[model samples]
Target: MKKNIYLDFAYFIILASTFGAVLVLGAVVAPVVFHTDVITVNLLIDPYNAGIIMGEIFHRFSYWIYFVAIYVIAYEAMAYKMGQRDAIGFASAFVVVCTSLLFSAIYVPKILSMQALGVEATQSDTFENIHIASEIDFKILALALIVLFIRRLLILRVPSK
Candidate 1:
Protein backbone atom coordinates (compact mmCIF):
# COMPACT_ATOMS: atom_id res chain seq x y z
CA MET A 1 0.00 0.00 0.00
CA LYS A 2 1.14 3.50 -0.78
CA LYS A 3 2.16 5.70 2.13
CA ASN A 4 -0.52 8.29 1.40
CA ILE A 5 -3.19 5.58 1.27
CA TYR A 6 -2.20 4.27 4.63
CA LEU A 7 -2.10 7.77 6.05
CA ASP A 8 -5.58 8.49 4.76
CA PHE A 9 -6.84 5.20 6.18
CA ALA A 10 -5.37 6.04 9.54
CA TYR A 11 -7.02 9.47 9.38
CA PHE A 12 -10.34 7.79 8.65
CA ILE A 13 -9.90 5.28 11.43
CA ILE A 14 -8.99 7.79 14.12
CA LEU A 15 -11.49 10.41 13.00
CA ALA A 16 -14.29 7.83 12.76
CA SER A 17 -13.41 6.62 16.21
CA THR A 18 -13.84 10.17 17.47
CA PHE A 19 -17.25 10.48 15.84
CA GLY A 20 -18.30 7.09 17.18
CA ALA A 21 -17.22 7.98 20.68
CA VAL A 22 -19.25 11.17 20.59
CA LEU A 23 -22.43 9.14 20.10
CA VAL A 24 -21.50 6.11 22.18
CA LEU A 25 -19.87 7.91 25.09
CA GLY A 26 -22.83 10.23 25.41
CA ALA A 27 -25.20 7.27 25.55
CA VAL A 28 -23.08 5.43 28.08
CA VAL A 29 -22.52 8.48 30.23
CA ALA A 30 -26.20 9.34 30.28
CA PRO A 31 -27.20 6.30 32.31
CA VAL A 32 -24.01 5.84 34.26
CA VAL A 33 -23.68 9.38 35.60
CA PHE A 34 -26.93 11.20 34.86
CA HIS A 35 -29.86 8.76 34.76
CA THR A 36 -31.55 6.30 32.45
CA ASP A 37 -34.43 8.69 32.11
CA VAL A 38 -32.03 11.54 31.70
CA ILE A 39 -30.96 10.24 28.32
CA THR A 40 -34.53 9.97 27.13
CA VAL A 41 -35.33 13.35 28.61
CA ASN A 42 -32.29 14.77 26.92
CA LEU A 43 -33.89 13.86 23.63
CA LEU A 44 -36.58 16.45 24.35
CA ILE A 45 -34.10 19.16 25.30
CA ASP A 46 -32.95 21.87 22.93
CA PRO A 47 -29.59 20.07 22.73
CA TYR A 48 -28.22 23.49 23.76
CA ASN A 49 -30.97 25.32 25.55
CA ALA A 50 -33.19 24.17 28.39
CA GLY A 51 -36.27 23.90 26.18
CA ILE A 52 -38.23 22.83 29.27
CA ILE A 53 -36.99 19.26 28.79
CA MET A 54 -33.26 19.29 28.33
CA GLY A 55 -31.03 17.58 30.80
CA GLU A 56 -27.91 19.22 32.22
CA ILE A 57 -26.47 21.24 29.36
CA PHE A 58 -22.99 20.02 30.25
CA HIS A 59 -24.05 16.52 29.41
CA ARG A 60 -23.99 17.47 25.76
CA PHE A 61 -20.93 19.66 26.04
CA SER A 62 -18.72 16.96 27.50
CA TYR A 63 -19.31 14.83 24.46
CA TRP A 64 -18.22 17.64 22.15
CA ILE A 65 -14.85 17.84 23.88
CA TYR A 66 -14.26 14.15 23.35
CA PHE A 67 -15.28 14.44 19.71
CA VAL A 68 -13.00 17.44 19.07
CA ALA A 69 -9.97 15.73 20.54
CA ILE A 70 -10.48 12.98 18.00
CA TYR A 71 -10.60 15.34 15.00
CA VAL A 72 -7.53 17.28 16.13
CA ILE A 73 -5.51 14.07 16.07
CA ALA A 74 -6.85 13.06 12.70
CA TYR A 75 -6.27 16.51 11.17
CA GLU A 76 -2.71 16.47 12.35
CA ALA A 77 -2.22 13.14 10.60
CA MET A 78 -3.84 14.20 7.30
CA ALA A 79 -2.02 17.53 7.15
CA TYR A 80 1.29 15.77 6.69
CA LYS A 81 0.79 14.03 3.32
CA MET A 82 -0.49 16.85 1.14
CA GLY A 83 0.95 19.90 -0.61
CA GLN A 84 0.67 23.51 0.55
CA ARG A 85 -2.90 24.05 -0.61
CA ASP A 86 -4.14 20.83 0.92
CA ALA A 87 -2.25 21.69 4.06
CA ILE A 88 -4.11 24.97 4.29
CA GLY A 89 -7.41 23.18 3.81
CA PHE A 90 -6.63 20.67 6.53
CA ALA A 91 -5.51 23.46 8.83
CA SER A 92 -8.71 25.37 8.24
CA ALA A 93 -10.75 22.31 9.05
CA PHE A 94 -8.65 21.68 12.10
CA VAL A 95 -9.21 25.24 13.30
CA VAL A 96 -12.94 24.90 12.86
CA VAL A 97 -13.04 21.63 14.72
CA CYS A 98 -10.84 22.96 17.48
CA THR A 99 -12.91 26.10 17.86
CA SER A 100 -16.11 24.12 18.00
CA LEU A 101 -14.63 21.87 20.61
CA LEU A 102 -13.45 24.85 22.59
CA PHE A 103 -16.90 26.38 22.66
CA SER A 104 -18.56 23.07 23.35
CA ALA A 105 -16.09 22.20 26.06
CA ILE A 106 -15.46 25.54 27.69
CA TYR A 107 -18.59 27.57 27.08
CA VAL A 108 -21.07 24.74 27.32
CA PRO A 109 -19.82 23.89 30.76
CA LYS A 110 -20.13 27.49 31.85
CA ILE A 111 -23.64 27.68 30.47
CA LEU A 112 -24.60 24.50 32.21
CA SER A 113 -23.12 25.79 35.44
CA MET A 114 -25.03 29.04 35.15
CA GLN A 115 -28.25 27.22 34.39
CA ALA A 116 -27.63 24.84 37.24
CA LEU A 117 -27.15 27.74 39.60
CA GLY A 118 -30.41 29.23 38.33
CA VAL A 119 -28.50 32.11 36.82
CA GLU A 120 -29.93 33.29 33.53
CA ALA A 121 -27.63 32.50 30.64
CA THR A 122 -27.73 34.66 27.56
CA GLN A 123 -27.87 33.04 24.15
CA SER A 124 -25.68 34.46 21.41
CA ASP A 125 -25.38 34.11 17.66
CA THR A 126 -21.81 32.80 17.99
CA PHE A 127 -22.92 29.34 18.99
CA GLU A 128 -25.06 28.93 15.90
CA ASN A 129 -22.33 30.29 13.63
CA ILE A 130 -19.71 27.94 15.05
CA HIS A 131 -22.01 24.98 14.63
CA ILE A 132 -22.64 25.90 11.02
CA ALA A 133 -18.97 26.35 10.19
CA SER A 134 -17.92 23.09 11.83
CA GLU A 135 -20.59 21.22 9.94
CA ILE A 136 -19.48 22.68 6.65
CA ASP A 137 -15.91 21.60 7.30
CA PHE A 138 -17.02 18.09 8.16
CA LYS A 139 -18.92 17.74 4.90
CA ILE A 140 -16.06 19.15 2.87
CA LEU A 141 -13.57 16.76 4.44
CA ALA A 142 -15.82 13.79 3.76
CA LEU A 143 -16.27 14.87 0.15
CA ALA A 144 -12.55 15.37 -0.26
CA LEU A 145 -11.93 11.90 1.09
CA ILE A 146 -14.27 10.43 -1.53
CA VAL A 147 -12.57 12.39 -4.30
CA LEU A 148 -9.13 11.32 -3.12
CA PHE A 149 -10.24 7.70 -3.07
CA ILE A 150 -11.39 7.88 -6.69
CA ARG A 151 -8.24 9.66 -7.74
CA ARG A 152 -6.08 7.05 -6.05
CA LEU A 153 -7.90 4.24 -7.80
CA LEU A 154 -7.42 5.95 -11.12
CA ILE A 155 -3.73 6.38 -10.46
CA LEU A 156 -3.45 2.66 -9.75
CA ARG A 157 -5.15 1.75 -13.04
CA VAL A 158 -1.88 1.99 -14.95
CA PRO A 159 -0.53 -1.40 -16.01
CA SER A 160 2.46 -2.54 -13.97
CA LYS A 161 5.68 -1.27 -15.54
Candidate 2:
Protein backbone atom coordinates (compact mmCIF):
# COMPACT_ATOMS: atom_id res chain seq x y z
CA MET A 1 0.00 0.00 0.00
CA LYS A 2 1.17 3.47 -0.89
CA LYS A 3 1.23 6.07 1.87
CA ASN A 4 0.49 9.70 1.28
CA ILE A 5 3.58 11.42 2.59
CA TYR A 6 2.03 14.88 2.67
CA LEU A 7 -1.02 13.92 4.67
CA ASP A 8 1.01 11.84 7.08
CA PHE A 9 3.49 14.65 7.54
CA ALA A 10 0.72 17.13 8.17
CA TYR A 11 -0.75 14.85 10.81
CA PHE A 12 2.56 14.54 12.63
CA ILE A 13 3.15 18.25 12.47
CA ILE A 14 -0.25 19.07 13.87
CA LEU A 15 0.13 16.54 16.68
CA ALA A 16 3.56 17.81 17.61
CA SER A 17 2.46 21.43 17.48
CA THR A 18 -0.50 20.73 19.70
CA PHE A 19 1.71 19.04 22.26
CA GLY A 20 4.15 21.94 22.21
CA ALA A 21 1.32 24.43 22.68
CA VAL A 22 -0.03 22.55 25.70
CA LEU A 23 3.44 22.39 27.24
CA VAL A 24 4.09 26.07 26.69
CA LEU A 25 0.71 27.20 28.04
CA GLY A 26 0.91 25.03 31.15
CA ALA A 27 4.62 25.31 31.90
CA VAL A 28 5.66 28.67 30.53
CA VAL A 29 2.57 30.79 30.09
CA ALA A 30 0.48 29.91 33.16
CA PRO A 31 3.25 30.47 35.71
CA VAL A 32 4.26 33.76 34.17
CA VAL A 33 0.70 35.01 33.94
CA PHE A 34 -0.26 33.94 37.44
CA HIS A 35 2.92 35.19 39.06
CA THR A 36 2.44 38.92 38.82
CA ASP A 37 5.62 39.33 40.82
CA VAL A 38 7.52 38.13 37.75
CA ILE A 39 6.45 41.07 35.59
CA THR A 40 4.48 43.45 37.78
CA VAL A 41 7.18 45.38 39.58
CA ASN A 42 5.45 48.73 39.19
CA LEU A 43 1.78 47.89 38.79
CA LEU A 44 -0.27 46.00 41.29
CA ILE A 45 -2.47 43.38 39.68
CA ASP A 46 -4.73 41.61 42.14
CA PRO A 47 -5.37 37.88 42.09
CA TYR A 48 -8.80 38.40 40.61
CA ASN A 49 -7.40 40.49 37.79
CA ALA A 50 -4.74 37.90 37.15
CA GLY A 51 -7.37 35.20 37.06
CA ILE A 52 -9.33 37.21 34.54
CA ILE A 53 -6.29 37.59 32.34
CA MET A 54 -5.60 33.87 32.47
CA GLY A 55 -9.21 33.11 31.75
CA GLU A 56 -9.10 35.25 28.63
CA ILE A 57 -6.03 33.46 27.44
CA PHE A 58 -7.63 30.08 27.92
CA HIS A 59 -10.85 31.23 26.32
CA ARG A 60 -9.01 32.20 23.17
CA PHE A 61 -7.08 28.97 23.21
CA SER A 62 -10.30 27.01 23.39
CA TYR A 63 -10.86 27.69 19.69
CA TRP A 64 -7.58 26.06 18.81
CA ILE A 65 -8.38 23.09 21.03
CA TYR A 66 -11.69 22.64 19.26
CA PHE A 67 -9.98 22.60 15.90
CA VAL A 68 -7.41 20.08 17.06
CA ALA A 69 -10.10 17.80 18.42
CA ILE A 70 -12.00 17.80 15.16
CA TYR A 71 -8.84 17.34 13.13
CA VAL A 72 -7.70 14.45 15.30
CA ILE A 73 -11.07 12.77 14.96
CA ALA A 74 -11.14 13.10 11.19
CA TYR A 75 -7.55 11.97 10.76
CA GLU A 76 -7.89 9.00 13.05
CA ALA A 77 -11.19 7.93 11.57
CA MET A 78 -9.73 8.04 8.09
CA ALA A 79 -6.70 6.05 9.19
CA TYR A 80 -8.91 3.48 10.82
CA LYS A 81 -10.94 3.13 7.64
CA MET A 82 -7.73 2.55 5.78
CA GLY A 83 -6.96 -0.42 8.04
CA GLN A 84 -4.09 1.35 9.84
CA ARG A 85 -5.35 0.53 13.28
CA ASP A 86 -3.58 -0.21 16.57
CA ALA A 87 -4.59 -0.35 20.21
CA ILE A 88 -2.21 2.27 21.55
CA GLY A 89 -2.75 4.74 18.74
CA PHE A 90 -6.51 4.42 18.96
CA ALA A 91 -6.45 4.88 22.73
CA SER A 92 -4.18 7.91 22.52
CA ALA A 93 -6.28 9.54 19.82
CA PHE A 94 -9.39 8.87 21.86
CA VAL A 95 -7.79 10.48 24.87
CA VAL A 96 -6.81 13.48 22.81
CA VAL A 97 -10.32 13.97 21.46
CA CYS A 98 -12.01 13.54 24.83
CA THR A 99 -9.60 15.73 26.76
CA SER A 100 -9.59 18.40 24.09
CA LEU A 101 -13.36 18.63 24.11
CA LEU A 102 -13.49 18.51 27.88
CA PHE A 103 -11.03 21.35 28.27
CA SER A 104 -12.60 23.57 25.64
CA ALA A 105 -16.25 22.74 26.17
CA ILE A 106 -16.61 22.04 29.87
CA TYR A 107 -13.63 23.37 31.83
CA VAL A 108 -12.94 26.68 30.11
CA PRO A 109 -16.59 27.69 29.88
CA LYS A 110 -17.22 26.85 33.52
CA ILE A 111 -14.17 28.74 34.63
CA LEU A 112 -15.14 31.75 32.56
CA SER A 113 -18.65 31.73 33.98
CA MET A 114 -17.28 31.56 37.49
CA GLN A 115 -14.93 34.41 36.79
CA ALA A 116 -17.80 36.39 35.41
CA LEU A 117 -19.68 36.01 38.68
CA GLY A 118 -17.05 37.94 40.70
CA VAL A 119 -13.89 37.61 42.75
CA GLU A 120 -15.84 35.90 45.48
CA ALA A 121 -17.04 33.27 43.07
CA THR A 122 -13.54 32.61 41.85
CA GLN A 123 -12.32 32.28 45.42
CA SER A 124 -14.90 29.67 46.26
CA ASP A 125 -14.09 25.98 46.72
CA THR A 126 -16.04 25.07 43.59
CA PHE A 127 -13.88 27.26 41.41
CA GLU A 128 -10.73 25.90 42.98
CA ASN A 129 -11.81 22.31 42.36
CA ILE A 130 -12.74 23.01 38.76
CA HIS A 131 -9.48 24.85 38.16
CA ILE A 132 -7.50 21.96 39.58
CA ALA A 133 -9.38 19.46 37.49
CA SER A 134 -8.79 21.50 34.34
CA GLU A 135 -5.10 21.67 35.05
CA ILE A 136 -4.93 17.89 35.41
CA ASP A 137 -6.93 17.43 32.22
CA PHE A 138 -4.56 19.72 30.32
CA LYS A 139 -1.62 17.66 31.49
CA ILE A 140 -3.35 14.50 30.41
CA LEU A 141 -4.03 16.02 27.00
CA ALA A 142 -0.36 16.87 26.62
CA LEU A 143 0.70 13.33 27.46
CA ALA A 144 -1.82 11.85 25.06
CA LEU A 145 -0.73 14.11 22.20
CA ILE A 146 2.91 13.21 22.64
CA VAL A 147 2.11 9.53 22.83
CA LEU A 148 -0.06 9.72 19.74
CA PHE A 149 2.56 11.71 17.84
CA ILE A 150 5.33 9.23 18.62
CA ARG A 151 3.17 6.20 17.87
CA ARG A 152 2.00 7.65 14.57
CA LEU A 153 5.56 8.47 13.59
CA LEU A 154 6.67 4.93 14.21
CA ILE A 155 3.73 3.42 12.43
CA LEU A 156 4.15 5.62 9.38
CA ARG A 157 7.91 5.41 9.00
CA VAL A 158 9.04 3.77 5.77
CA PRO A 159 10.86 0.44 6.09
CA SER A 160 14.40 0.20 4.75
CA LYS A 161 15.31 -2.54 2.27
Candidate 3:
Protein backbone atom coordinates (compact mmCIF):
# COMPACT_ATOMS: atom_id res chain seq x y z
CA MET A 1 0.00 0.00 0.00
CA LYS A 2 2.80 2.40 0.80
CA LYS A 3 4.43 1.61 -2.49
CA ASN A 4 1.18 2.17 -4.32
CA ILE A 5 0.77 5.52 -2.62
CA TYR A 6 4.24 6.62 -3.69
CA LEU A 7 3.66 5.43 -7.22
CA ASP A 8 0.40 7.31 -7.38
CA PHE A 9 2.09 10.48 -6.27
CA ALA A 10 4.80 10.08 -8.82
CA TYR A 11 2.27 9.41 -11.54
CA PHE A 12 0.28 12.51 -10.69
CA ILE A 13 3.33 14.71 -10.59
CA ILE A 14 4.54 13.44 -13.97
CA LEU A 15 1.12 13.85 -15.54
CA ALA A 16 0.66 17.35 -14.18
CA SER A 17 4.09 18.48 -15.28
CA THR A 18 3.59 17.05 -18.76
CA PHE A 19 0.22 18.76 -18.97
CA GLY A 20 1.74 22.07 -17.95
CA ALA A 21 4.51 21.71 -20.50
CA VAL A 22 2.01 21.09 -23.26
CA LEU A 23 0.02 24.16 -22.29
CA VAL A 24 3.05 26.39 -21.93
CA LEU A 25 4.60 25.33 -25.21
CA GLY A 26 1.42 25.76 -27.20
CA ALA A 27 0.16 28.91 -25.51
CA VAL A 28 3.34 30.78 -24.63
CA VAL A 29 6.42 29.55 -26.45
CA ALA A 30 4.89 29.06 -29.89
CA PRO A 31 3.39 32.53 -29.93
CA VAL A 32 6.62 34.17 -28.87
CA VAL A 33 8.71 32.17 -31.31
CA PHE A 34 6.40 32.70 -34.25
CA HIS A 35 5.72 36.34 -33.64
CA THR A 36 8.90 37.97 -32.45
CA ASP A 37 7.62 41.33 -33.59
CA VAL A 38 5.09 41.21 -30.79
CA ILE A 39 7.86 41.78 -28.24
CA THR A 40 10.70 43.32 -30.22
CA VAL A 41 11.10 47.04 -30.87
CA ASN A 42 13.38 46.80 -33.88
CA LEU A 43 13.87 43.12 -34.56
CA LEU A 44 11.66 40.89 -36.65
CA ILE A 45 12.34 37.23 -37.19
CA ASP A 46 11.49 36.00 -40.64
CA PRO A 47 8.64 33.50 -40.96
CA TYR A 48 10.93 30.84 -42.40
CA ASN A 49 13.39 31.27 -39.59
CA ALA A 50 10.55 31.27 -37.12
CA GLY A 51 9.34 27.97 -38.54
CA ILE A 52 12.82 26.53 -38.20
CA ILE A 53 13.03 27.73 -34.63
CA MET A 54 9.61 26.28 -33.81
CA GLY A 55 10.55 23.01 -35.51
CA GLU A 56 13.62 22.74 -33.30
CA ILE A 57 11.55 23.41 -30.21
CA PHE A 58 9.12 20.65 -31.12
CA HIS A 59 11.97 18.35 -31.97
CA ARG A 60 13.31 18.67 -28.46
CA PHE A 61 9.85 18.38 -26.95
CA SER A 62 9.28 15.15 -28.89
CA TYR A 63 11.71 13.32 -26.66
CA TRP A 64 9.82 14.45 -23.60
CA ILE A 65 6.56 13.28 -25.13
CA TYR A 66 8.06 9.87 -25.83
CA PHE A 67 9.11 9.55 -22.22
CA VAL A 68 5.72 10.64 -20.98
CA ALA A 69 3.97 8.17 -23.24
CA ILE A 70 6.06 5.30 -21.96
CA TYR A 71 5.50 6.32 -18.36
CA VAL A 72 1.76 6.64 -18.86
CA ILE A 73 1.57 3.20 -20.43
CA ALA A 74 3.62 1.56 -17.75
CA TYR A 75 1.69 3.18 -14.94
CA GLU A 76 -1.67 2.40 -16.45
CA ALA A 77 -0.68 -1.19 -17.08
CA MET A 78 0.44 -1.60 -13.51
CA ALA A 79 -2.79 -0.10 -12.23
CA TYR A 80 -4.78 -2.47 -14.38
CA LYS A 81 -2.81 -5.45 -13.17
CA MET A 82 -3.56 -4.34 -9.62
CA GLY A 83 -7.27 -4.44 -10.47
CA GLN A 84 -7.74 -0.71 -10.13
CA ARG A 85 -9.37 -0.21 -13.48
CA ASP A 86 -11.89 2.32 -14.76
CA ALA A 87 -13.15 2.47 -18.31
CA ILE A 88 -12.87 6.21 -18.67
CA GLY A 89 -9.45 6.28 -17.08
CA PHE A 90 -8.23 3.55 -19.40
CA ALA A 91 -9.73 5.25 -22.43
CA SER A 92 -8.18 8.58 -21.53
CA ALA A 93 -4.84 6.93 -20.99
CA PHE A 94 -5.12 5.27 -24.37
CA VAL A 95 -5.82 8.60 -25.97
CA VAL A 96 -2.88 10.12 -24.17
CA VAL A 97 -0.56 7.40 -25.32
CA CYS A 98 -1.80 7.37 -28.90
CA THR A 99 -1.67 11.12 -29.31
CA SER A 100 1.69 11.39 -27.66
CA LEU A 101 3.13 8.76 -29.97
CA LEU A 102 1.46 10.25 -33.01
CA PHE A 103 2.79 13.70 -32.29
CA SER A 104 6.28 12.63 -31.39
CA ALA A 105 6.79 9.86 -33.92
CA ILE A 106 4.77 10.81 -36.95
CA TYR A 107 3.98 14.50 -37.01
CA VAL A 108 7.26 15.84 -35.72
CA PRO A 109 9.33 13.78 -38.13
CA LYS A 110 7.13 14.69 -41.08
CA ILE A 111 7.24 18.36 -40.22
CA LEU A 112 11.00 18.30 -39.83
CA SER A 113 11.42 16.50 -43.13
CA MET A 114 9.26 19.07 -44.91
CA GLN A 115 11.21 21.82 -43.22
CA ALA A 116 14.46 20.30 -44.41
CA LEU A 117 13.11 20.61 -47.92
CA GLY A 118 13.15 24.37 -47.33
CA VAL A 119 10.68 27.26 -46.96
CA GLU A 120 8.92 26.64 -50.24
CA ALA A 121 7.92 23.14 -49.19
CA THR A 122 6.66 24.35 -45.83
CA GLN A 123 4.63 27.03 -47.58
CA SER A 124 2.97 24.53 -49.87
CA ASP A 125 -0.58 23.20 -49.53
CA THR A 126 0.62 19.77 -48.43
CA PHE A 127 2.57 21.22 -45.57
CA GLU A 128 -0.35 23.44 -44.68
CA ASN A 129 -2.67 20.42 -44.41
CA ILE A 130 -0.18 18.48 -42.33
CA HIS A 131 0.38 21.49 -40.09
CA ILE A 132 -3.36 21.87 -39.56
CA ALA A 133 -3.69 18.20 -38.75
CA SER A 134 -0.82 18.47 -36.31
CA GLU A 135 -2.47 21.41 -34.59
CA ILE A 136 -5.67 19.42 -34.21
CA ASP A 137 -3.70 16.46 -32.90
CA PHE A 138 -1.96 18.70 -30.39
CA LYS A 139 -5.27 20.07 -29.14
CA ILE A 140 -6.60 16.56 -28.77
CA LEU A 141 -3.45 15.55 -26.95
CA ALA A 142 -3.87 18.41 -24.47
CA LEU A 143 -7.50 17.47 -23.84
CA ALA A 144 -6.58 13.83 -23.31
CA LEU A 145 -3.84 14.71 -20.85
CA ILE A 146 -6.17 16.89 -18.78
CA VAL A 147 -8.86 14.24 -18.82
CA LEU A 148 -6.39 11.56 -17.77
CA PHE A 149 -5.02 13.79 -15.01
CA ILE A 150 -8.48 14.51 -13.57
CA ARG A 151 -9.60 10.92 -13.88
CA ARG A 152 -6.49 9.62 -12.17
CA LEU A 153 -6.83 12.19 -9.41
CA LEU A 154 -10.41 11.16 -8.78
CA ILE A 155 -9.50 7.48 -8.89
CA LEU A 156 -6.66 7.95 -6.45
CA ARG A 157 -8.77 9.94 -4.02
CA VAL A 158 -9.46 8.11 -0.77
CA PRO A 159 -12.80 8.77 0.82
CA SER A 160 -13.10 9.54 4.51
CA LYS A 161 -14.04 6.49 6.60
Residue ranges of candidate 2 with Cα displaced over 4 Å? 158-161
lDDT of 3 by residue, 113-157 (tens): 999999899999999998888888898989998999899888778
Per-model TM-score versus the true fold: 0.41, 0.95, 0.94
Q: Residue 132, candidate 1: how far off, in angstroms? A: 12
The residue-level lDDT of candidate 2 at 105 comes to 99
What is the per-residue lDDT of model 1 for residues 50-156, given as tens digits with 9 covering 90 to 100?
A: 42123353455457555655655564554444321244445544554654555456655544454554423334455445434544544444444344434334433
What lDDT would candidate 2 get against the real structure? 0.91
Worst 10 residues of 2 by lDDT: 152-161
Best by TM-score: 2
Any idea how many clashes model 3 has?
A: 0
Q: How much lDDT does candidate 1 score?
A: 0.46
> What residue pairs are clashing in model 3?
none
| Global lDDT of model 3 | 0.89
Q: lDDT of each prediction vs. the true structure?
A: 0.46, 0.91, 0.89
Give me the runs in candidate 3 sitting further than 4 Å from their true place. 1-3, 158-161
